[model samples]
Target: MRTFLSVIFLAAFSLFSFAQQPYAPAAALPAKNLAMFGRGLYPGNDTTYHLLKRSGFNTILLSSFYIHADGDLYSGDSHQPIIHQGKWVGDAGYVKRVKDLKTKSSISRIEILLEGRWYGQPPNTFDFIRDWYDPAKAVPGIVTGTGKESTLYNIIKVLKEVLGADAICIDDESVYHSPSIIAMGKIAADLNMHMTLCPFKRNNYWTEILEASDNNLVDALYLQCYDGGVRNEIKDWVQGLKPAQPIYPIFMVRGSFSTCDTHKGSKSVAEISKQLRGFKKDYPGMSGAAIWQMEDLNSFVKLGCAIKQPSSGTAKSVAEFLSQLKKALKKEL
Candidate 1:
């Protein structure tokens, strides 16, 4: 068994080495797009956060919490249950981290994904909200079967007053929360915040969020391109909208086999660099790509499961690639 495992490792390494060769760029490269690198946060230290900033990532999608296996909602540090089954889970760490990033570095954006429901499977929309807002029971306007509560408003209030985040990415895993969506927009507007709701790829939802505000509530229409490599479809989706606001494609880094997914796709660090090179070569509509997580990126390397072994060679290759990509964008665009 040991010998077989060794052979498997050797074969994987050989494949990675061979895949590192340079490739000819396609005849035409699209206009360069700006991209971002980010990750999820858990309770504890901010080692990964510092690592990403050092690695040249300017934006982060910092998650507040999720419903754990124990069915208890856990928030990062600051301990505010950012979300319960389908209700508000408020925590102070969420605001603190954002403020720290702003004060500490030149971090450009912090996309606050309210009530994200990524479990063993993508959580149901209702499950995205906490159970306290359940409609079959009490809570009138507070929930309204939308699973929304005024408490979420308070959380946003704290974010604006305290952290001063640039944008809020509301993952409306649930689609029917018009009142909640509208109310959330109003709060954002009062604070002069840029708001976006990543609906389940529904155009109407984006339109509703856009129209609901006194001014344009929605500044961006984010598509959660989680499954399959769908870059080609993204252009059409962006242009297909009636009014056509800016469309930001937030690719999943750890969820799919596409270049966006961090695990299992590229074989080595050099290969990962090449993947970024290819993005510059294609996809014009792409504003930028965010690493779904720095946690996944580091974990894959730590466990020896990353496509390419994490060594100085791999890390340097990735850094050089990102540096060149950014430089290329500045030079060419």
Candidate 2:
């Protein structure tokens, strides 16, 4: 009889425990805040940083910090304000541009895109920045956690102290494993740097990522609503993650003049607003929308979000763009 009672008691306890778990969110949520991504440099656009400062996006996820083969992270060269040494330098003047932006406006945060090396780019071209996270190399210490002594941990420090990064965006397309994803979040949290994940799928990997991280360390997930994830429904994606986790549906700014990628799926400004609102209706806590390349955004996403920006095609300078955007936004407000 005691054994029978014990079984019943255990089963009851299990049921109670499951019932106590937090509820998954439902309902479309408002966009948390608008955001954008950009490479730190452009050929002739010296005022790129200044223009971005006035663009009114809450955060800017800079394109990227390369994870090395072993476990180290590349934080530019030894210089205090990292400047690329190589000639065809992709992220050249990263430190300086970020510094410039902070000086200009009060955008919420500036972050780094921790991405794997591109498939087409030759390994030699990336050696200067050590950009090589792949299925083979994997993310060395992200899951298990990295301590102060760890190179990856120090890289976080370098980002905070040197570049003044307010957060770190985990764009780990290489390894979607939960352990590493969780570890990366924990490490970034320990350093006082906010962690945001930009995931491509709505699957078990993300579910586990939130559950293992306890959905605490990660501030948001920049869901790629466009590009390969175009078919991804924001409502379902939001439900897949914990209710507390903010989601920002990021769209790709495509076309010939577009700087993000060659993938072209041009939606009108009205369509973008409708899709974003649909997500908000289903999940109210959504942070907002984000565009992949700020430079390529033109006026579609900006206008949809009510962020008045420069003319898509014009000979205007960055200063002129900022001036006009400010005036436009002031009138709208």
Candidate 3:
């Protein structure tokens, strides 16, 4: 009987120890502040560093790599895509800059959005039509159809070698099926990285992508709702996401160009704060939100809206409004 009691005690102790194991935060929860800063296509510059520091940004999302013309993987106009001529881009010293900055800055995460689609497509900025699709420059076994042989697989392989980033955003032009998305997700996992899928549309394209997510491809759903001042529409879209899944709302001020438009008659930062406060109250599960840019502060003023700048009128006003919004959000939470 004593032996039996001893065995029971041991089992209880073992269970207690297992339960006490350190808790790793769930990947779905929005990371601190849910704040992601967008850098211009080319951001290896001083202005970018100043803007990121002044703003309360915690993540830097960059688009520095590109598959250049001439069938080279990493050779773009200015920066070479890391995996050029079958070589790693990071090894070539591009991502090294990002890592160096990351070590020095308080930003906890860095993401490289890999733009996909063969040369000659609508958004193919590489002039891929002239270079990658040329029949003569093609490498027989590897270059395949378009001669842009750096398939999603090859491009990612090089990126992993270089950036060693915490996350990768798959900016595929036209994603339809789950297998393709899941395939991409598996590739990310193989590299010990998390994936964020950007499916840009107001249509039902995301419905199909959501169906395909069976623990394979994505850690977060990055939806770009560029319409500003439409609080109800934005609320509806947020509600449409799966109740349990995490969603990051991308609020645009430029590039996608939502900030240049009228703010539905609100002429000041105070009015904008009122709308944001209402939205935060309506949506409790919102992990966090991100602005499309740090530039374009002028566009808001032209539309008769104002922001708090650091010094003087613009910075001070905008900061107070943001602080108030933050306080209101905390109360709601």
lDDT of each: 0.48, 0.55, 0.48
Question: Residue 147, candidate 2: how far off, in angstroms?
Answer: 1.8
The residue-by-residue lDDT of candidate 2 on 1-333, one tens digit each, is: 999999999999999999777432221122446666765343215456666777665577776456444334543222122322211123446556776775656466777777655443534212312222122343434322255654455566777766677677866554455665565666676766667778877467777767766444566788877756888887887666654677777765432143322345434333455566677678765556776665544433333322232223222343443344333322322
RMSD of 2: 10.4
Off by over 4 Å in 3: 1-31, 41-43, 50-54, 64-82, 89-94, 116-120, 123-150, 172-177, 202-204, 214-217, 227-232, 254-275, 294-333
lDDT of 3 by residue, 1-333 (tens): 999999999999999998776323222333544445344424345544544544444666665345544334542224544455666533334354655655555566666665555442543422342233334555444442222243445555656656656566755544344444455555566565667655555335555555655432455655554443233344665656552445555554421233433333322334334444565666666656544443334344343333333111242333433343344333433
Model 3 alpha-carbon miss at residue 107, Å: 1.6
**TM, every model:** 0.60, 0.65, 0.61
**Model 2 reaches what TM-score against the true structure?**
0.65
Q: Give the TM-score (vs. native) of candidate 1.
A: 0.60
The model with the greater lDDT, 1 or 2, is 2
How displaced is residue 19 in candidate 2, in Å?
Answer: 28
Residue range with the least summed lDDT across 10 consecutive positions in model 1: 24-33
lDDT of 1 by residue, 207-311 (tens): 665676543446555555443333334545555554434454444333223232344332333433444445445445444444444444444444433334333
Order of all candidates by TM-score, from best down to worst? 2, 3, 1
Name the Cα RMSD for model 3.
Answer: 8.3
